[model samples]
Structures are given as structure tokens and as C-alpha cells.
Target chain A: MSLHDCRKAFSETLVALAEADPRIVAVANDSIGSSNLKEFKKRFPERMVNVGIAEQNMVGVGAGLANGGLIPFVCGASCFLTGRALEQVKVDCGYSRSNVKLCGMSSGVAYGELGPTHHSIEDLAWTRAIANLTVVVPADPAETSSALRAAAAYEGPVFLRLSRMPVPDIHPADYRFEFGRAPWLRRGSDVTLIANGTMVARALEAAALLEADGIKAAVVNMSSVRPLDREAILEAAVAGPILTVEEHTVVGGLGGAVAEVVVQSHPARMRLLGFPGEFAPTGSPEFLFEHFGLNPEGIRRAAAQLVEESARVAHETHPVR
Target chain B: MPPDSVPTDAAAESVSAAKMARRIRRSALQMVHAARLGHPGGDLSAADILAALYTAVLRIDPRNPRMPDRDRFILSKGHCSAALYSTLAEAGYFPREWLREYMKPLSLLNGHPDRNKVAGVEANTGPLGHGLPIGAGAAKAAKITGASWRTFVLTGDGELQEGSNWEAAMAAAQFGLDNLTVIVDRNRLQQGDETERTVGLEPLAERWRAFGWAAREVDGHDLEVLIRTLRAVPFEPGKPSCVIARTHKGRGVSFMEDRVEWHHRVPTAEELSQALKELGGGDE
Candidate 1:
């Protein structure tokens, strides 16, 4: 499997799309180098706006640009873009329903060595709480390109959460991206492993491990977190216990979203795997994932435990039946 | 030019503006009193500026508020929605009857301005320090497209305490957005206390000038000067313009003028009658 940086695909696709659309403009808060906007600036200098280290102002400016009949792709570090400008996002874009594309780059623990301050574990929660804002987390390069295109075409506010950590291409070259839909990467019957972003690749590998242990584990990639795929979740719940894996916190991320769907539609047992609502210690992205039990082996172990526990509960409830 | 520079038509425009200002204040007071909640002080204080812009200055079509070439106006201090709604209604943006529904359940006239719900509203702004950045962005868009239309934003003096405004102020200067104009409603009072005592925005015009904008001060209640100054775009070449309009917290209502308690207080029946009498006559 070849590793790919989604930001590269995103930047390339943005430049190509901008060539066809004059209204497409890139707005950032002094993050051209980090956001991979150098090439975009070179190709379309007139369309790039770099607000110096002001995330709130950048977001407001994006909304204003949209009001002036221009499409603005506001890019910044995930933590500051969402944390510092949450009110601007809530009022200017969400409540006002401005057509601004907010690109949150290096989301989750992708900036691992920088410690907890840079980790965007809380971004999903923050953005998902706002109405009229679509939150999308693409798993790989192909999905990233497709999601960016879709967001540009959609006439409303969208938060595109992108990771800086390199992830392997899991989807086919011709895979079509659809909003509010979760696609099954690998199907099984015993249990379901739901994940997104960097965790999707890990979940697939975990399913392979689970298959070796005589367990049929289904792998579903849930990219669009806000307008979730409730039907898919309900279908997956009928099989067995669902294990939700993510690079975010256990609360208010993909796990929380799936739980919300399942609890309301179909009550089922599940295990949520991610950061457990605390600041992570300094480490690399790989180390952080390993330390947090997000590796393939760790996920397989958790899945086994969930299946075993559910079997015990079922047996206890109906003895000799 | 000095801060008090007056235009040739100052006398005639002032008479007309004073009448309009009185009506606006009366309408705003009535809305706040009827709703039993609102920032009457800011509403009353910003009446003259709103009247001046909607009547004598803004190049807008009431019939077509979203015209491509029409100028944009954003009220940053959105707690003054009563004044904005009354001004918009008086200018025929919508029926005056809508004023009666102010702050009511499911009313189009929200507590703050909502651009989507209201016809003439350019942006939904309730939070402070938002309008300037948006206005700067609009100006930048016009510059990029090489369009002739301009953008204007009004913010309270206390609202400048938010650092986002300064960030946008820097961008406005850095981009050389000459098509943008920010009028600071220097009412010198916030919700709790005086702005200077709260956070100190003195040497205010100088602060704007230091940020690379063409800064000027004017009497906010003087409609002729306000209109004349607004007509003078750019103030200087290659720079954004900042007009510091010195105003009382509550201008027309004698009891509420410059009082912090009236910042978010509704007028009683007797006080409402007194305010209406002071403005001109009984409410329309």
C-alpha cells in the first residue's frame, strides 16, 4: 500500500478547480506553507488572501467574501481555526448560512509532537454543534479531493477536516464520494468496526486480524460525521457489537455520532476507542496512536473483548433457551 | 479639515435630519417599550447616524436591496437593532407595521439584525467586532473584481475592545482597501460602565491612524457633516477611511442620555410618554 498526503491532493485539486471557476479564492491566516497553498498562490495570486495570524478575522472575511458573491476557501491550522473562531463560525457562517468553505488542516493528533494544544480532537464536537454547517472528515487522498469538490459545488457552509499524517489509499481510484453516506470497506457478520480519517486504514487491518482469530469483522468508513449515515449504522448494529474507532476523543466525535444514531434507532452494545478526554503527552503521531490503543492489534483486541462481553450478556439473559 | 467641518447645505439638511432623527428615536423607543426588552440607549444614540445613512447618504434602492452595484451597510453594534429596524422601515425597506413585532415570537425583526430574514439587512450581526472584517472583505472583493461599489460598517466604541477588529483593521490597511469605510459610534458608554473607564479607547482617531487608515472625528448627531463626510470616500488615496462619530449613549431621550442603566433597559409607560413628548409629539 502506498502512503499519500491528503493535503497534496487537496491543494492540487483546488488549483485545477480554480482554473475553471474565477470565484474560487483561498483565504488563510498566515498558513500558506502549512496549508500547502504556495502553488495555489503562485497560480492565482489575485485569488489568495493571507490574513496574518488572525483566525477570527479570517473566518469573518471568508463570510464577507461569500456575501460579495465570491467563494472563499478559508484554511488554517485545525486547532486555532476552530477554537479561536468558533463564534465566528457559529454566527457568521452557520447561523447566517454563509457559503464559506472552512478547511481545517492537520486535524486530530496529526500534529502529535507539538502536544495537546495543536491536537484538534475537539474540533468535530465544536463544529458539529452548529446548525447549517456540514462537517466532513475524508479518510484518504482520493476522498479528500472528492469531498473538496463536493463542498465547493454545494452552496452553504462546510467544514472540511483534513489530516496531515500520511494515510494509505484505501478507496479505489474511481471511487465516488457521497455526503451523509457510510460505505462498507469490508463486510462481515460477527462484529462491525466503524472508523474515519487515519483510523480507517487501521480498522481494515484490524478486520484482517479479527478474521484470523475466527471473527468476521465488518469495516465501515464513516467520513461525513455531521449528517451521519443512520441507515448504515442501523444495518451494522443488527450484525453484532459495533466498535467505533477514531483519531479524536471518545466524546462528540465519530464514536459519539454513531452512538447517537444507534441509541435512538436501534439500541446496541458498542465500544468507543479514541482519546479519553485528556491532554495527550508529547509523542509522534504513530506513537500517539499506539499509546492510545488505536493500532491494528489494539483494535482487534478491543473487538474481541466487545464480542465476548456481548455473548456473555446474551447467554446470561436467556439461559437454556 | 477640522472635525466640525460643515457642508453648504448644513442648515437645510440638519432641519430635515433632525425631524427624521426624532421620528427614528420615537419609533425605536416604542419598539423597545412594547417588547419590554432591548438596548434603548444604543438605539437612541445611533438614530442620527442611521437616519443620515438611510436617507441622505446610502446609494440603495428600497425596491431592490440586493442590486449588484448597490453599496453595502453593516451595523456591527447589533444591540442597536431597534434603531436599524426603525430606520429600515422608515426608509421603506419593509412595512412600518413590522416594528410592532420587534422581539416578538417568530418576528422577522430579531433581537439582532438577521440578513436572511430582513430585506435591507446586508449582514446578520449581533456580536461585536464582526462587521469591520466583513466590510473589509466586501471591499476587497470589489477591488478584486474592479467594481465601483463601496462598503460601509458601523461599530460601537466599546465594541473595539475585541482584538478581531484590530486584526481586520491591519488587513484593511495592508490591502489598501480604499473602498471600505468604518464609522465608530463613539458613544463613550458600554453595558456596565463608560468605555474609557471600562477599557480606555481614548486617542481613538489616532489609534486608527496608527493602523494606517485615514482617521477623522465628527459630531455624530450633526447630520449634514455626517452626510458630507460619508460622501467623501477614501479620505485619502490608498487607505481605508475611519470616521469617529462622537455621540451620547442615549441622544434624544433626556432621562436616558449617557446613562449606563438604560443600555438594556425598557422604558416604563410614564417614561415612554415623556420620551415621546421630548422627541416631538405622541407616537405615530
Candidate 2:
């Protein structure tokens, strides 16, 4: 498995989309270099709007462009795009129902070691709370490109959270991304491990490790956070316990979204694997993943424990009947 | 304004706009009195500018508000909804009867403008400093697609304190959105105090000029001057235009004019009667 930056796929797909559609416009907040939009700007110079270091204005402008019969993909760092310009996102896109695509780059701890201010661990929580928004967290390059196409084709407001962190291709080149489906990557009945973004690949790897220990663990790529795949979550819950891992905080992230669905319907035993309501200390993303037990080994350990807890509780209730 | 202030076309338009402005002020005051909740000060201050833009300058068809070539107007000082709704009603966007439902429970006429619910409303704006950026984007779209319509945004004087406006101001110039124009209601009063005492936008025109726009000041309540200034687009060929509309908060009513408390204070029956009498009687 080789690591590939999802930003490359995002920009390539965006430029392709622009070439076909005249309505496609890019609104950047002086994040051309970081967002990997140089190619896009080179090809569609007039189509790209560099708003010069103002996330609030950038979002407002995106909303405005949508109002003017143009589709605008507002790109910026996830931290500032969602955190700093939250009200603009809520009012302009959510309430106004503007047709805008917000591509939040460098999500999660992709900017790890740059400190918590740059980390976008709280983005999913903040954006998920807003209505009229479809929040997507794509795992790899193929998934990222598919999500981008889906976002442009579907109207209203959509937020695509892309990561700068390199991850191996998880889906096939011909992968089709759906907004509200949780695809079961490796189906097993013992326990279900749900994750998205960078954590999906790790969850799959964790399933392998759990298999080595004779534990048949399932892995579900639950990418679309807002319009959750309730059927898939309920299906996973019916098998056994569920463990959700994400490259975000334990509160209001992928794990929280999954729990919101599962508890209301399935009521399964669960363990949320992510940053537990604390800012990450200074470390590389790889180190932070290890420290917070987001890696294959840690995830396997947590999932195995959850499965045990579920089995023990079942045994106590059923009593060999 | 004097009827003979300009040539026939300009004079006729200004005279009609001046009457519309008067009607807007009267209707807005009555709506505020009916609702028992509104920003009457800013509404009266912005009435003339709204009237001029909606009538004399904007190329909008009240029948086909969403026509591709029609100009766009966004009231950024959205707390002045009574005046805007009155102006829109007077312009025949919707029946004038909707003005009575101003701020009513579950009414389409929200305290702020909603583009989805209201015809002739280009954008949903209530929070300060949002319209210019949206308008700049709309202008950029026209520039991008080679469309022929222009975009205008109206903001309160006190709304300039939000740094987001400067960001928009800089970008509107950077993109050289000549098709876009912003009118600042220089009413000098916010909800709490005078803009001078609060955040001091004294060098306001210079501020816009420094941000790379063709900035000018005008008497916001003067129909002829406001109409004349607004009709001239792109003040410069390459820069965005900024018209600093000098106005007095609560301009139409003598007692309420420039008074801070009237920023959102509801009028008593006698005050409403006196206000109506001053405006040549209300709703008639």
C-alpha cells in the first residue's frame, strides 16, 4: 500500500468539473498553495476567486456567488473554514440554502505539530449540527474525487472534508461515492468497527489484526456524517457491539455521529476511539494517532475488548439457553 | 428635492422616487407601530435610499424579479426590514398588504430579508457586514459569465465595524468588480450609541477609497442626489463603486430623528399619530 495525498485528486477532479461546466467557480481564501489549487488557477484563472486571507468574506462570497446563478466551491483550511466562519456557514449556506460546495482541506490533525489552533478536530461536530448541509469525510483519493463529483451534482450546500495526510487507496478506481450509505468493507458478525476519513484504512487494518486473534470483526466506512446511514448502523448493531474510530475528538465527530444513530435505534455496546475532549499535544499526525489509540493495533485492542464486553453481558442475560 | 432640479427624465424619476420615499417612510412607521417591534430609526434613515435604488436605479421587473438581466439589491442593514418591505410592496414585488404582517408569527416577511421567501430579495441578510461580500460575488459572477446586470448592497453606517466588510472591500477591488455598488447608510447611530462615539467611521469615504473603490458621499435622504449618484455605475471603469449615503437615523420624524433609543423603540399611539401627521398621514 502506498500513501497518496487526497488534495491531488480533489484539485484534478475540480479542474475537470470546471472544464465541463461553466457554472463551476472556485473561491479560495489565500490558500492556493496549501489547498493545491495552483493547477486549477492555472487552467481556470478567471474562475478562481482568491479572497485573500478572509474566511468569513470567502464564505459570504461563496454564498453570494451561489445566489448569482453560479456554483462555487469554497475551499480553505478546515479549522478556519468551519470554525472561524461558522455563522456564515449556518446563515448563508444552511439557512439561506445556497448551492455551495465547501471543500475543507487539511482536516483532522493533518496539520498536527502546527498546534491545536490549526487542527480541525472540531469541524465535524460544528458542521454536523447545522441543517441543510451534507457533511462528507472521504477516506482516500478515489473516494475524495467521487465525493467532489457528488457534491457538485447535488444542489444546496455540501461540505467535503479532505485531508492532507497521505493514505493508501482504500476504494477501487471505479468507486462510486453515495452521500448517505455506510458500505460494509469487511463483513464479520463478531463486532462492527465503523470509521471514516484516515481512520477507515486503520479500521480495516485493525479488522485484519482482530482476525489474526480469531476475532471476526467487521469494518464499515461510514463517511457521510450528517445524513447518517441508519440502516447500515442498525444492521451492524444487530451483529454485536460496535467500535467507532475517527481522526477527531470523541465529542461530536464521526464516533459521536455514529452513536447518535445507534443508541436511538440499535442500542449496541460501543467504545468511541478518538481524542477524548482534549487538545493534542505537540506531535506528528502518525505519533498522535498512536498516542490516542487510532492505529490498527490500538483499534483491534479496543474492538476486541468491546466484543468481550458484549459477549459477557449476553452470557449473563441468556444464561446458556 | 425641487421638481426642476434636473432635466425631464431625471427630474420626473426623482420626483416619483421622492414620493415613493415618503410613502416608504410612512408605511414603515405604521408597520413598526403595528408590530410593536422594529428598528424605526434605521428604517426611516434608509427609506429614501431604498426608494431611490428600488425605483430610479435598479432595472428590476416586479413581475419577473428573478429575470437574468434584472439588477440585484441586498439590504445589508436588514433590521430596517419595515422600510424595505414597504419599498418592495410599493414597487409591486408583492401585494402591499404583506407589509401589515411585518414581524408577525410565521410570516414570510421575517425581521430580515429572505430570498427564498420574498420576491425581489436578492439575498438573505440580517447580520452586519454580509451584503457586500455576497454582492461582490454576484458582480464577479456577472464579470465571469459576461452577464449585463449590476448588483447593489445597502449597509448601515455602524455595520462597518465588522472586519468582514473590509475583507469584502479589499476583494471587490482586487477582482475589480466595476458592476457592483455598495451604499452605506451613514446614519451615525447604532442600537446603543452614535457611530462616532462607538467605533468612529469618520474617514469613511477615505476608508473605502483606500480599499480600491471609487468612493463618494451623498445626502442619503435627497432623492435627486441619491438617484443621480446611484445611476452612475462603476464611478471608475476598473474599480468597484462605494456611495457613502449621509443620512440621519429616524430622518422623517422630528422627535425620533437622531435619537438613539428609537433605534428599535416602538411608538406610543399619540407618537405614532404625530409621526403619521408629520409624514402627511399614514397608509393613505
lDDT of 2 by residue, B117-204 (tens): 9998888889888888888888998999998889999999899999989999999999889999999999899889988898899899
TM-score of chain B of 1: 0.95
Residue pairs of candidate 1 with colliding backbone atoms: none
Candidate 1, which segments miss by more than 4 Å at Cα? B1-15, B281-284
Model 1 lDDT tens row, B5-38: 3443655666777777888899999999999999
For all predictions, the C-alpha RMSD in Å is 3.0, 2.6
Score chain A of model 2 by TM-score against the reference chain A: 0.98
Per-candidate iRMSD: 0.7, 0.8
Q: Which candidate leads the pack in lDDT?
A: 1
lDDT of 2 by residue, A125-202 (tens): 999999999999999999999999999999899999999999999999999999899788998989999999999999
Q: List TM-scores for all candidates, in order.
A: 0.97, 0.97
Cα-based lDDT at residue B281, candidate 2: 38
Point out where model 2 deviates above 4 Å.
B1-8, B281-284
